[model samples]
Structures are given as C-alpha cells and as structure tokens.
Target chain A: MAKKDDSPDGLKLDRRNFFKTTGLAGLAESIAAPAEAAAQSTPAAVGPGDVPVRLNVNGRQIDLMIEPRVTLLDALRTRANLTGNKKGCDRGACGACTMIVDGRPVYSCSTLAIEVQGKQIRNVDGLATGDRLHPVQQAFCEKDALMCGFCTPGFIMASVALLEKNPNATPEQIKKGLDGNICRCGTFSRIFEAVSSVKGGQRG
Target chain B: MKAFAYINPANEKEAVAALSPQVEQSMPLGGGQDLLARMKDYVTQPERLVNVKTALESTVTPVGGGLRIGAAMKMADVAEHPEILRMYPAISAAAIEVGTPQIRNQATVGGNLNQRPRCWYYRNEEFVCFKKGGDRCFSPQGENQFHAILGAGPSFIVHPSSLAVPMLAYGATFRLAGPKGERLVPAANYFTLPRQSLRMENVLAPDELLTHVILPAPGNVKSGHYEVRYKASHDWPIAFATVLIAMNGSVVKEAKVVMGAVAPVPWRSAEAEQALVGKSITEATAAAAAEAAMKNARPLSQNGYKVDVAKTAVKRAILRAAGIQTA
Candidate 1:
C-alpha cells in the first residue's frame, strides 16, 4: 500500500518542486494551479471517516457505518455477514461479485455501498427460503454444476436474476444472460445444463 | 482505495460547485462503475468523490428529430430505448456490446465516454507510465498486443470508448457544464489525441461535468456497428467500426466511417469515406473501402493482427449498413 501524503490535492503545486520531483519541467508550469476552490469547498462530506448508511438488502433494511470508499461487496461481506458472494477479481472482470440491484445485475465490487442506499439489493445469501434451495440452486446441486464452489453464488445470483427476467429464456438467451458469470471449476457444460433444465425458472 | 470524503450533490449546479479546480482533489461519480474500480486500483486518488447520479438527469428526451441522452442515463436503458434503436441504431448497437449486461446496467453513458484507457500498463500500479506523470510510455518496449495500431505516438493507448465511435460517426455533441457555465463540444473534438495531452484522453477539464449527449436528427441514414471481441463472455473488443451511410437511392451520397479500440481517439477514416462516397456498397466497394481504411495503419510488433481484425470490422460494417449479409 502507498503511504498516501496528507496533502488534500495529492500533489504539490510548487512549480520548481514538482518539476524536481517528477522530472517533468515544461509541463509543470502549466499543470500547477493554485487551490482557489479550496476556500468555498465545504460540501457535506460523508466520510474519510465512517458514516451511517442504510441499504435495502434481500428484503430488510440493513444499516451500517462504513467509510465512503467501502464497496457494496465489502460492506455486505464484512459488516452485514453476507459472505455468499465471493470476491474473485475485484476489478469487476470476474462475475464472482455479481448482485441484483433494482431488477438488474451489477458488479457489487465496483458499486459503492453508500451510493446504493434504498435500492433493492439481492445477494446469494437471501436466495433460499428455509431449507428448500432456490430452483437454480437446486438445479446446480442436482446437475453437479460446481466443483470448488467458490464461483457458485455469483453464478446462482446471476442465473436467478436472468431467469426472473426471462423465465422461458431460450438456449441463446441463457448463454448470453449468464455470460457475466464464470465457473473456474470447469463445470460450464453442467452449469448450462442446470440452467437449461430449470424449466420456467424460480420466482423471487 | 485511499480513504476519501464523499458528497451526494443535490443538483448539477451543486455538483459543479462542489468540484475542486484541481483534478486530484475531486471527482464526479456516476454509478461508481469506473471511478470506484480505478480508486481500488490506486490509478486515480481523488480526495473527494461527488456522487453525480442524482445530480445529473437520467432522462432520454427527444430533441427535435434526434435525442438528448442524459449523462447519467444507464447503458442498459440506452441499449433498449426505442427512440435510440429506431433513429440511431449504431448507438444502441454499440451500447449493447459494452462489457456485460451487469456493467451495462450499472455504467452510465457519460461514464462510458469518459472512462480511462484500459491499457495494462496504465491499469497496473507497478508501472508508472506517461499517464501516471512518468517520463515514457512502456507499451512500445513492453507487452503491446492490444495497443494502438493507428494514430500512435508518445503513448500508444487506444481510446476505450465503444460509444464514442458510433457517437462520432452519427455526429453528436457533448454538453459540458462547469463553474464557467455550459458549452457544447462536437464528438469529433471531444476525444483528444496522445499529442494533445498525455495526462488525460479527452477535452474535459477537471471541474467540468459532462451533462448530456445531444445527437442531431438522424434523417434517412443506414447505420451499422460491428465489434470483434476476444471474449464474448465479457471483455473489451479487439477492434470495432461504426458506419453511417447516407444513400441517394442506390449509390452512397455520403459516408462516415469511425473505428474504435484502434487509436487514441475514435478514428474517422476519411480514406474509407472517400472510397464509398459515389459507389454502391458491394463486395468489391466495401472491400476497397476496408482496404483503404488500413492503408495507413502502423501496427506495433505484437498488434499487427488487430489491423486484419479492424479490416474485417470495417468491411462487415459496410455490408451491414447496406442491409446485406456477410459470408
């Protein structure tokens, strides 16, 4: 981790000093501008510190005090104790951090928890009702769609959202809809079979 | 991500006011789709992140004959909007191909347009390349399979906006709002070249907020957008092309050909446009235009394959514009 300097702007404006530091001379004079807006710049800052945030997750409003930079995935996993969603490739490439927010799937790792307040956010933790697994989950279990099971929840959530939107999805739609999720277990053939055999899919 | 103060501004004016004059101080957040990722990677360390989702409008309103797409309008909505599909099919087509459905659902139109380059060297914090205030670009001497082949320079990073290619081909303008008020910049002029400024890709100043994308009326034009992605399961395209053909009954009255992921900007191929001006789009003509488009390509050591991929994209776009099947 970088030892971030306490400077508010993250850079020094002294032309000679910046030039000497970065060894960029000609661009220094043009780049260095005074912090003129710093005077009138007091907006309602939420946090470098933790602040109260309420999110409607799975059906209930879960509240927490998190830093402004805390991602939705981190907030849920670390605070709310919803660890069903995995954090594979937190950069939003892998679908392990996928979640459904307001009827559409999104990368939870890329979404800030504070920004998604009041949104109907659903994670894999809330999928089942008591002992009965969600149909997609049941299908995955029956079809043996997972090996390591690390990427299962994200795939299940993405599948649930996909099936909810298009219950009678065709094969092509199933392929396209579940494209965001990946199973490193190399159980894709079985995963596709599982999704395909779910019939009209499960309801929320 | 370095800890930062956050603000959810009430309106665009408030958001503009909240912006710091310096780029490093404050940043506008729409959906947190790109900004948060970069913050996590330590690529950009803004002192404050101003949530612009509520500040910027999300409506897609009819502007005379065309549409004015709000900066905060989600990509999922843009891809499915009836007006956009009917008038500017290329925009919708391009929008649908961005990342995956999840990313499209979360990422905004303006965010897509203003997103940073996906060059590996830029994304990896280990390498302090030119964009990171370092002296030289590492692409020329390093791994550059996905780097720019056309219009390369001190930095060989390709412009990563898929929408900008179709937007420029359709002749759109971006509305920028700032402390100094609002001004419109043409899509062609919105994206800056490597020579223009190595620090940033576009003309957007640190304080200005890209408010809306105003597209002029699309009248009697056939358009096609084709993208070649290495991973259909969600990855950036190898290269893509957008073609807008204004036909005079049978022959091409005018043509606008723009390609993405090929250069530092949504590169408009005047050579291809010139080739198609007075000719009907046929196997021969389209091939000729595609050939002309690649005539000046200066591919790097590893990205020579992209030139051929780009050629296929341009040719297929031409055929698709004419509503013909590609074999």
Candidate 2:
C-alpha cells in the first residue's frame, strides 16, 4: 500500500483521492484503471496563470487569452473574427478551414490555436487589399470557380499558397495540391481552369 | 471540443517533467488532425492537452547509411523533401497519398504513424465495436467492404496510415521516447494486429512518444507503391501494395512484399517474398506471388472482392518496381 500525504486541509493525497480529484474516479474504478494507473497520470488542467498568446495573423500581432484546447480555426473565426477561413468539416477532412501558417498552407481546424503564436498565419481574408482581390481570387471569380461558394475561400487560399511555392506547377501538381480541398457542388473543372489561368499569367 | 489545459514544453526534459504525475486527465496533442476530430465527435474527451511540438529533439539527418526523419516533421515536408524523394520515392509517394493537401500540411509523420483507424464503426459514436471494448466487432458482418482481409480475427479495421506499409517495406525503424528514456522499434513490429492486441494498434505505452523514423539507405533496392481506389482524388485506397526488391542484374536477390488496406496491420506476405526470391520478376512470378499473398485471406462476404483486388495490386506493384511490363 502507498503512504498517504496528510495536509492541513484534511485531504489525504492517496491514490484514491489523486484519482478522484483528477476526474478519473469512474475510470479508475473500471478495469482499465489499474493498467492506466500503473502508467503516469494524464496532464493536469490549464490554470489562469498561463502566459498570454500573441498570434501573428496576416502580418499583424494580436494578443488574446486562449485555453490550450482552442484550435487555430476557433481562434481565427471566433476570437479574432477572421471568418474568411470557414470551418466545413472541422476535422481536417474538408479543407474549408485551410490557411497558411509560416508560409505553409495547413488546415487551421486541426492546428492548435496556441501552437502558432509567433508564426505568421495567412487566411483568405489576407488576399485582398481594401477592395482589390488577389490574382487567384480574381481568377476564381472570373472563371466562376465555385457553385455554392462554401469551399471557394479554402480552394483560393490553397491555390495562392500552391502558386507561391510552384509558380509553374503542372496540371498534375495542381491536381495533387488541390486534392485536400473538396467542393461539394462539383466545380472542380472551373477551379482547375482558374488555377491554370493563374499559372499561365505567371509564366507570361 | 471539451475545455482543457494546454502546455507546450521547450525541450525533451521539460516535456518529460511536464508529463509527470498530475491530475491524471491529460492527453498529448500531436498534429490534432485525428485527436481533435475524435474530441469533437466525442470519441475521446480529455481534460488536459500537452503540446510536445516544441520538445521535438530529433532531426532529419543522413546518419550511418540511413535517413532519420524527425517525427515532428509534417507529412508535406516529408513529401517534398529532396533526399526523401531521391532515396525513398515510395515513402514520398505514400506521404502524398495520405488524406488531402490540408491534412498532409498539418498532419505530422508521427501522428500519421500513430493515428487511429478510420473504421466506420469506430468513427460513429453509436456503434461500440470490439475495438471500443464492445462484445462484438461490428465490421465482421456489417458494412465490411472497407475492413481487413489479412491478420484479422476479433476486429477487422484496416490500418489507416498510407506511409506505414512502404516504411515497413523499406525496413524503417521508429525512434520512441518514453518514461524509461529513448528506444527504437522496427517498422515491421511497430503496428500490431487485432489478433495480437484488440485494444491497441502499436506497442506505445501511455507515456511513449514517437520521435523519428529511420529509413535504411536505398542500396540496390527498387521500391514502388500502387493504390487502387474508386476516385483518383483524395480518397483512401480500396487496396494497395508496396514492393521493395533487392536485385542483382535483374535476378531477384531478396524481396519485401507488403499490402495496405487489406489487413488489420500492414500485411507482410512472407510466401510472396519467398516466391520472388531466387527468381527473376516475370509476369508468371508476379502473378504467382500475388496469388500466394492472398492465399490465407478469409475476407468477409462483402469484402471478398478485396482478395482479388489486393492480389492484382500486389502483382502490378511488383511488376512496376521490377521494370517489367505486364500485358
């Protein structure tokens, strides 16, 4: 038997209390407990004293208080109000929440909000200057690259990031690159045309 | 989805210490591609999330006749890596085959290797399959077209990682960090089948963290991957095969045959490998190996076609790697 630590608060810090206070009381009593308890305890909850998170979004530094579980999509859409990055699947399946993190386009929904505190984050909202749209966005609109337009922002942002990396990306590369973003309305042809047009312009 | 505390440690020591005895309600946050989705779907609910991204100590280096890929390295980074593309083209090909572009960008190599299965029963909150400690495996009779055709007994979920199959074929090893310190496990034994353990996929302890993957240098070995899917785009393959052949002037010296989406784990066909050894890769040999590979398959009624599909894929992949044309 393990010895218990006695405190002035009359709390016995034994395995039972340790398990109880940790929210594993039910699990601890289950068959999985003895095995899990032999291993190290899970991480503790976040306290209030954690440092403030400084998010660099679209080349601008913004400070906010976020819990550890807050995702980048939630931070961008809910806290920072950058709604251009839509949350379609929220599970990294649908690329509707795609954004550029430190020059690499990623699914913001699958990235923790606090992870990219110092890294630069570029969303669909960053593509426009006041009223003028980015070239990729312009081409997308001109070619009617969207039907329902829900997956357009993510596709456009992904295209911009892809074009930035491979200025002369082949159609096959474009196809592979855009494989992450899914448009439910089946506007793949127009989207491919828009991307190809952008590539052609860059070459000329 | 649930409220949780998060901590990002700067070093491995700090990470280990931070993971020390606490409230006992924690889970490590990796790429968050799978973990976050599980959380949102209520598959798992953890009160604390420890972020170990900053504590990555491994580096992608060409060390001692092998390339060490840091576990923290993103799938996109691995897919685009020059050395990786030049040496282990199959690995790069596998990395590119996983999920979609957004997933590849955010999903880490470690997370991909350690990700949970995408079985419909496991994904659905309603069905509590044998994997979830239920009495029966839902995949045995109900909607098992996507289930395994090899090394499956109690559970029939297919191994989800597209990279693991090729890694095993290339003789890769995983560098792991745990409470006892660092250790390495061969890719062949890294993934566990349902017969071995129904509850877990890999032999990772609760505290163990995969640090990197070490791939032996491609020395006179030719490797390739072939995946057959309904859609040509961002969909998991219905069946896939990865072949690594060691050749001496077109004569087979040795061969490693592995198949994905056809097994509870990455299925290694020793018989198929045996059939390839000591013989040149001919159309007849490839076909024979494919047949031998699926000889022990006890596929479900709905998934019976997978046996043929997987065999064809294995044959095609072997021929492609051996530079042989099959009419």
Candidate 3:
C-alpha cells in the first residue's frame, strides 16, 4: 500500500497538488467547457482504477465500471454479454472484430471503449430482427458463404455496412469492400456471390 | 496494454498541455489503429493517452491556391474526396491503397504519416532490437526477407508509410503544433533515418501534434503512384513509387521520384530525377530512369528479390504518369 509503484495515485496526487498550488487547475477548468470534459475537468485523473462507462451497443444502453485499458471489443463481449464479434488477430490486421460506428466499419479490438462513448455503435447483434435475418445474413446462410462459422458474424457486419453504403457495387468493389475479413476456409468466392446477389439496396 | 488514463481534449491547445515531457509517459492518440496495436504488444507503455481526434483539425480547406487537409480526417474521406481526386490523383490513389475499407475508415492522415516500422524484430518482445532501446538491430544477421534494400545500417526496417511517398513527391509541408508554438516542416525533412533518430521514426516531439498537411498546387505536372504487393488485397507493399513529372510539351522539365517500403524513410532518388530531367518520357526513358533509381540499391541477403520489384514499380510509375499503356 505504501509503495509508489503500486498505485497511480502516487504520481496523480503529486500532479494534482502541484497544479492546484500554481492555479493552473483553474485555467484548465475555465476553458475546457465541453461535454467531453468529464475526466479532465476534475483535478483527478480517471484510472488504472475503475470508472463509470456508459455504452450504447445494438440500441441498448449498458453501464459498467471499466478500466481505460479495456478495448471496445472486450467491453462489448465480456461485460455487456454481446459476443457476436470474434477476436481473430486482436491486432488491426484481421477484421474479425469489425463493427459499424457512425456508418463506418472500424476495428473494435484496437479502439478504446472510452473514446466511442457518444457515437452510434451497431454490431452483429443488432442486425437481425428476430427470425427475419438481415439481407446479408440471409445471403450468407443461403450461399454457404461461411465454413468455420467463427468469422461469420464479423463478415456479416462488414458486408452489411458495405452494401448499405454502395448497394449497386460491382464484383471488383465487392471484393475490395470485404477484403478486411479473412475466411481461413477460403470461402471468398461464395462470399462475393452472397454480397453481390442482394437485390435493390440496403439503407441501414 | 498497460494501465493508463485517457483524456479526450477538446482542442489542440489542451492536448499538448496535457502531454508529459517524457515521450514514453504520455502519447497523443490519433486513430488508435497504430498506437493501440503497439500498446497491446507492450512495445510502448504510456501512462496517459490524450485523444486528439476531436481536438485537431478535421476539415479540408483551400489555401493560397493549394489544399490544406486536416490531419484527423479519415483516409476513407480523403480517398473519395472529389477535389483531392481531381487536383492530386496520386494522393487519392495512395490513400485508396492503404489497408482495407475498415482500416481506411478508421485510420487518420496523421496516423498514416506517423506510423512505425512493421519490422517483426521491432514488434516482438523477445527481440530487444534498437527501436526498443536495445544496443543492436537483429535484422542484419537474422531473418531479413522483408528488410530494407537501399538504406541499411544500425536498423534496416523500412518506413511503413505509403502516404508519405506522395506527400514528399508533391512537396507538401506538415504543420506541427507544440507547447512552444506552431512550425511548418517540409515533407523532405519530416521523416528521419535510423542513424538520425534511433528511438523514434519522425521528428515530432511527444507533446507536438501534426495538425494539417499543406500541399502546394501541382502546376502542370503529371503524377502517378504504383506499388508492388505480394497480395492484391490488404497487405503491405514490397516496394512502391510515386513519380511527379513536370513536362514541357513532351520533354520532362522537372521530376520528383520518391519510393516507400524500401528504406528507413520515404526515399527520394535524385539520380532517377536527373535521368528524366531532359528526356521525353518514352518507354526507354522510363526504363532508364527506373534503372538509375535502383543503381544504389544494395539488398540484404534474403531481400534481393525486392530490388527487381522496386525497379518495376519505378518504371511503371513513370509510364503511368506519362499516360502511356503499361502492362
């Protein structure tokens, strides 16, 4: 409990008192008047310790106490009980952890949960409306676009985001759109067919 | 990733003020695609990370007959922007070729320019290479297949930036904001070689933020970007070239030839530019310029194949810039 290496409070407390005495803390409070000024507005830094994090995942609000080191994918899969997206490479290379944030597909494993607090997040869990599968999901099942089923959720999410944006995508564009996700079973040809065969457009 | 505090600053002034003097203690998070990956690998352990996405510039503006693009703008927007596609096609071409659709949507302009080398020795915790503050680099005697061919020394890791090639070819300048003030650094001097900077890749300090890239207007020049990759989809290039040639009718008046994924920095070849200065950009002239570009390339033991790949990229880049049919 006494060792400075044990807790971040050792350095945090010193920095807090130093800023308070110098009146620099007042300067930080006066100018930063934005909604994102939650942690910085207060004199104390948030954590290596647990702080409150409110996430909006798949149209449902889930609140939890998470450390800053927890990624968006980990927070969604572990605490929120939304485990549709798989973690393939954990790095940004593999797209198994892909999720749509504000109309763009992003690598959720590399993104911090705290940074995406105010953005609209949509994952594989939000896609299907009960028995009626999403167009991309229905296409995947019909065309057998998946073999292992591990990468299916991420692939479905990526395809949904792509087709919703460019519904009239050509074969080349479809190939480039879903290039992030890798089916180790090498079912790319069938995946391409599933994506391109969707008639009309996906607005969502 | 190590335990740290995260802060989303509302402005660049707040971002730099919150940074620690020690570079390793505090870092400015751009896209988090590069920094977070490094953090997860334990290659970088910062005590605090300041999110600069909303704080930095995020809009593109026309300035002094040139374009000033915000550093926080995503690569997806930059690749599809109509003005960028019309005015600077090479820049759009390079941006479009970056990772995947998902990566382009997430990666930022500043993040792409300031990314670290993709050397396996640097990423692995087992090998304490020069980039990790160790005494020696392990690439020279170790597995050297993807190592550098042109710039080889204490560290042989090629710079992992594709946008920097076209930025240097267009003679763009990066606006860097720091605690002191703001300063504009030329793209030619922005990236550093291993001997110049051992522990880091670029000249930016820990507290500084690259806000915008100001590109000068391309005056009657043809630009082309070409990259030779092992995979057609979502992979790092073996070698890439960006060639900008100012042509007077049919003869080349000026040329700027830069290559990426071949050295510790975005390598600009003066020999290739000199070879094409006074000649018409025909098939033979483009081949001669490409030959001159790879003349000084001394490959490592396992990377001799990269020399031919890089030479083909240079020749094809010249031919494409001249609007010639290149197969």
Fnat, 2 decimals, each candidate: 0.70, 0.59, 0.64
Q: Tens-digit lDDT track for model 2 on B1-327? A: 555567666666556655543322466666788888887776666666667776774357998887998877888788889988889988888887778777777778888888888898988767877666677788876898888888888888999988998999988999878778888899988899887888779887666778889988778788868888888767789999899999977688999899999988888999999989888988899999999999899899799999989988899989988877643
Candidates' DockQ values? Answer: 0.33, 0.27, 0.34
Best by lDDT: 1
lDDT of each residue in B2-23, candidate 3, tens digit only: 6898777778888888787687
TM-score (chain B) of candidate 3: 0.98
When sorted by lDDT, best at the front, the candidate numbers are 1, 3, 2
The CA-based lDDT of model 3 is what? 0.84
Error of 1 at B310 (Å): 1.1
| lDDT tens digits, residue span B176-242, model 1 | 9999999999999989998989889999999999999999998888998899987875788999999
Query: Which structure is stronger by lDDT: 1 or 3?
Result: 1
Task: In candidate 2, list every pair of residues with a backbone clash.
Answer: A42-B24, A43-B26, A46-B5, A180-B101
